[model samples]
Target: MISKSTIDTVFETARVEEVIGDFVQLKRSGSNLKGLSPFTDERTPSFMVSPVKQIWKDFSSGKGGNVVAFLMEHEHFTYPEAIRYLAKKYGIEIEETQQSDEQKEQANERESMYLVSEYASKFFQHSLLETDEGKAIGLSYFKERGFTSETIKKFDLGYSPDKWDAFTNKARDDGYKLEYLEKTGLTIVKEDKKFDRFKGRVMFPIHSMSGRVLGFGGRILNNTKKAAKYLNSPESDIYHKSKVLYGIYHAKQAISKEDNCYLVEGYTDVIQFFQSGIENTVSSSGTALTPEQIRLINRLTKNITVLFDGDAAGTRASLRGIDLILEQGMNVKVCPFPEGEDPDSFARANSEEEIREFLEENSQDFIKYKASLLMDEAKNDPVKKAGLIRDMVNSIAKIPDNIQQEVYLQECSRIMDISDEVLYATLAQIQNKEVPSSSRQGKQKMEVVREKPVTTPKVDQLYILERNIIKILMLYGNEVEDFEDLLLKQNDDTGELILEPDVQQSKVFEKVFLDLQEDEIAFSNEDFRELYQVLINRLNTGEEFEIGNVVNELEPSQSKEITDILMQEEQYELHSWDRHDIPVKKKEQAVNQYVTQTILNLRRHLIDRKLQELLEGIRTAETEDERTDIKNEVVGFNKLRTLLSERLGRVM
Candidate 1:
């Protein structure tokens, strides 16, 4: 319901790089920026952003769009919600348009759940800051943890009263359906009875990376043996534990800026680290690591340091996650707290410098951590020792980079006192082997399948000539000058050489390229065709074409092509470093260079064949006049060839 003007203001004010950089750690790639794919787990950067285009594209996911689309895709926000988010971020005043009650009633269940969750977050925050019990318990708990009032407001910390049906009755009175309340896990309903889900607990709302409240994690204040220490919102439509990382919304910028992520296991662990001046930290929330979670971190950093609880079981359980990180091409290091300590306790005990120093000194490669922990169990037992070596080799094989994998293998060999060759051989075998016999058979069949051949129509010479014209248009479509050319015409009464004034063209590219533009000029791939059309549209609109915008619009495969085209090479050198430092040719000079060369090359090939025909006719001449004419034509053709070759810079 936000006004269009407000939306435009937000879009214009919000810098694409700045907004995306909150989640993506971007590095300069020529005129654009590149980063690891956020939509997929990747070690290498395949996601691109163009400040000029104000858009982004993930080459691995084949999803490209403007800032709004990224928010929608990454956070699963409805269009309205995304606009509202931008408006809030940019401090724009949102003026809602009138909507019919009937139209408003048509909102879907998922959207209703989002609405309910948002309302619940606000209600809890209000309760915490505005009520006595909440102030004494929830506010005090946060203040005791060193969270300032601004930080508390920033995170929207909240409290739910001991009254069970307080939230439920309030929501019902507000016209939010009970179904949505249950769907968002904010209210529990049983056999004609409804009550709040987190009553009597201090609230910590978990947010998606886009800052939408997905769920909540609540802590019980009163010590009671009958009550659980902590409770979380059950899996709902918007919150998937395996895919969501707590504190990511707040910590993403710090994580990306540092180029490293600190992975912890609990909500408090993340908050404490941030409070202690370590802001690049997120929690898995005690869940086993998932690929989706790994990709989320991968988008911001290629390096991750896991802080494990000092307990032996906690360390062993977290060791498996290292392989997942390795598979995604991330550099992982492990830091184990002292016995019986977690990140929360450890941070509370030391100063920021002390905590940092401890991490720096103790963080070791995952392979080394695994070997160090497991080697003792296998000591003096040959079978167990061999088994441990194989386990390390398997973990090494999961690494995508050859150099990194080899390095890990060498380290493993040294640590286990095994031969390096043996470890290498084992890793190679593990990598080459298929997942299973059935899967291998299916893959082999796919590899053996051959494509059928098809004939294609030959392009007319004019078509090739036109293609050259299109290429020129794509390269230099914004020229502000005109080009002049000679034109020949025949008078009505007599055929003769005539000179006429030819109006200078604004841009030869726009005139010629658009003249030949057709909706039917299809590409083999739809995405390529889509990208080509977008490029043409941008050129026709007299706007500066952005290769990143096209990349964002195209499929992932086609996006790679667009990115490669824009970033492949400089394509033209401005000036060479030499004595006197002469400047490169001006725009007009560059255009003329391209145009004159192409025209002359085409003319040379055409005339060279014609000259051969003229010489052949000299041998077949039946009359002296014909022979003389043929000789004259041959001389003229040779002269034309010489002129063209010179213009084209070719020795003929």
Candidate 2:
């Protein structure tokens, strides 16, 4: 376990840009920095880093948090892992109690294996680019398959030389541990001899979601019947073929944002689709789909569209994996390629829009396509058609949702020309056949699938307002600004009423705190309310407000929330401004405008709520005095709201 003191020092010393710069190439932009997002494949620089606040934000994916949060998001590191990474970078000593030798040895071994794999990957890439044999063979093979140089680099595609001991000799010369090399499957040691496992092949490094190299998959270049066409790293401590999906490290964010995952059978298919601008795709690494791999996609989304190869026999062979997906309660769609075409070849041939449109137009629900596929085998035969019905019913019985089960059953009736009653009877029989209690896996119920994925809904106004208030407090709370208070006046000559702005100078925090008290308004969000109290209490003392100090003391989630609020460039979360009216200005120049507008907006909301309360009180009045009192209160709120509306230039 890491000590609290060490965590504080790491946060204090870790520079967001410096650490992130190690991974992402950042260029200076005004007071901050900008770069293409490491978390996404982008053509422009949309990721931002604020050196002043020690935080980063990715506008491409809409994920922003502090430095440790960047590692957790970009690298998929656990909290402690991120902390330790930062500590090591900043040269901070972690104070943890000594552990058992077994525990320490296990942790060190895993890390050493990861390091060895990383070295091997880099070595292979260097060979692919720098060596004569690699370029003539491995690089030529990739270019022939229509992969670009940038695509090759992005996936770290590499080549292992044909010589038996080339890689092993290089790794040993570099002082890499022999045991680690053997464990990571980079070097095979047997009978007091050493040789590279992936020699004479083009290598594809398998990565974890955080981009750590876990293993490799190599494709042999020669036509040798004695050797397998493809070789994968054997199941080791870190690399489990059944548990990891290829390309998941790069495909995770797109899968979540699109709420859809394209399941294919090979690495090249995933790479081709990604190059074609469909980033939400992964492969099963030529292995059967396992529950653990399904669970990985389920963590990001429930929908999976399995892209089938053009070969009919290959398509038939993959149906068992689809059935496994159905049993796991995942929504499944299937799209079969035309004869003589697969995803790798088809994606290489098609443009991005054409490929996307094809997927949208051609993908069918699992039930429809499976029946169409099995019907080819039935061929108007009495016995085979019966078998088709039985097959469809068995797949339907795997579905856990009652509505989905009924809908698919009805669909089967329509397609097979069988009665719905007969289909339901067959389904019941299949579901009722009981196995041993210990052997049965309970199925989980999932919601019905949507026709299209929905983007996140807009956050409500109250949340936006509260976020604004705390944001202002965290950023400009101690900075002195001149605020305008709208005052009403009446002219004696024409009896015309007018509003005047009475200007006064005060710290931004004092005006917000005192004005909120004058109206007795409190934050609706519990966390905001607590943080507001903390900022106010600290600022109330005649001392400078240090945000870093406050953040260090808070829980991680709370600190991240406040950090996001503080580092935001756009302050008007609720108000979408027009350039013709209130043009965008630097935060320094817009402080008074924003502070006044936020307070006025908060007042307007609270006054409207108070007016509603008073109106309800009038409805339940017991006597004329109570009704009169409520009406007077409502009238006063309405007048004040009208003034606030005039100041904010927004009708309440």
Candidate 3:
């Protein structure tokens, strides 16, 4: 377990901008930075980062958080994993408490798989870099392909020895279970015979966008007729090939910075392009591009440039990914390498500048690319041309953005020599036709209106206080106020006034915070609980209570709650106007002040109600001591009510 001191060190050391900037291309927007949402595909910037507050919020998908929380959400890292990640990034040494066997067993299956995969990756890398046969075969193959030593190391390229049981034996001997090795497809076990699955092949360690190695791709160096050209790790708990994109871990930063992703095929293509200084490139790793993989890239960049080889199969396959990209609300451009050449060969043949220039000049939008590619086949056949036009419209219909769809329709109309109206109509028809058959069949409609929970005067009063507490949390959670003294009478025989100083030394937020702390009030929602806990801790540590940071720490639901309060229609301008030059009535300037006071009044009322409830509960106890406590609390609640009325300029 990570100690409290370790967590504090991570928070103090992990700069919000540095951690978020690794995944987002944050351009300065005043005191904050803005970028396209990493949680959703969008062109205009909605993901905001405030360096002052040390938090981020993505308005599109509604996910917001500090550095650790962001990593937890975006990379699927556990709390400890996120802390460890930041620790490693900032070079902080972590000292953890000892774990028992039960604690080890508590690691989730997915996490366990990830740990096993990481272990296997290190083992493979060691075999390649630390052994003679590995350097001689695997390293030599990569070096011969124009991959630098640095590039090989950066990608964690490795090789499995040709001998059977070499990797499996080593893994088993190192205390790794054979079941995990087989599950990750690192070893092939048949009839009590276990052998290395990727024997004699150079390894391409495939990683998640967060840089955790999920699985591997291996290319055969041998030309034997029996051996396949390439092999990849089988689908496992942590690795789903269809959903994984090669080089995303390395390319995410560049992709976001450029707002573009260059898609390629094969492991060599990814390595060659990245080594050539084009860092925003990823590969499907020779698999047919899946919607899931495209969506993953779309999260980082809205613009995708798919590089296709010259072959017919490549062109045909490129067509398959276009509709998927359009369905995901991304702008896709196709860049086909010269006939008989792939990205690897082309990048290797030409200079970086030349290759870059070629890509810039040749990259065409999907509408144009599809039309042009299919135009030859359609030739002068009216039937084929009609089919092609309909196909283009169908692809256009897949786009989610109305404006983008309209623009594409215009472009398609121009390219296909059809009318814009005709294309739009065709798109609508296709979209309507594509609706699910299940949705059209047997629909049972139940009109039910749930009754709103009855709100009593007590509840309303509590609601107001809750608002004030939230406001204080959002605005002045870190402020410390001097304790105020109040006089209270607590005797029957003598009219004696007891002087009680509010030794709390806390702001309004801190008062509510301390109350919750004492009661152990916990949020039921996971993300909300995390945000609430972190904010309280920050406030306690004398760290500035940044609204942005608190908002960012919240998960989507908590973000919505914050947004509803901060951005709602509670305040409006009071204006007077006339048709002529003269105004009918004077404009009011106290609108905002009134709103603020009303909110504060409501908040105070809520707190008073809660205090009253607590007092009443204490009174019901049969003990004299509890009764005495209730009497004291009653005084406090009365004083709170008096202060609340004073704040609103009302006489009690």
- What TM-score do all the candidates reach, one by one? 0.77, 0.58, 0.75
Q: All predictions: root-mean-square deviation over Cα?
A: 8.3, 12.4, 8.8
Tens digit of per-residue lDDT, candidate 3, span 288-390? 8888798787666779998989999988988888888888878889998889999999988988999889999999888888888878889999999999999
lDDT of each: 0.76, 0.82, 0.74
Model 2 misplaced stretches (Cα beyond 4 Å): 1-107, 435-652
lDDT of 2 by residue, 243-305 (tens): 789999789878867889999999999999998899999999999889778877765667999
Worst 10 residues of 3 by lDDT: 576-585
Model 2 lDDT vs. the true structure? 0.82
Q: Which window of 10 residues has the lowest lDDT sum in candidate 2?
A: 441-450
Of 1 and 2, the candidate ranking higher by lDDT: 2
Q: Is candidate 2 or candidate 3 better by lDDT?
A: 2
Task: Please provide, for model 1 over 196-305, each residue's C-alpha lDDT reduced to its tens digit, 9 standing for 90 to 100.
Answer: 88989989999989888889999998988888888999998888999999999888998888889999998888888888889999998778999889889888888899
* True-vs-predicted CA distance for residue 48, candidate 1, Å: 2.0
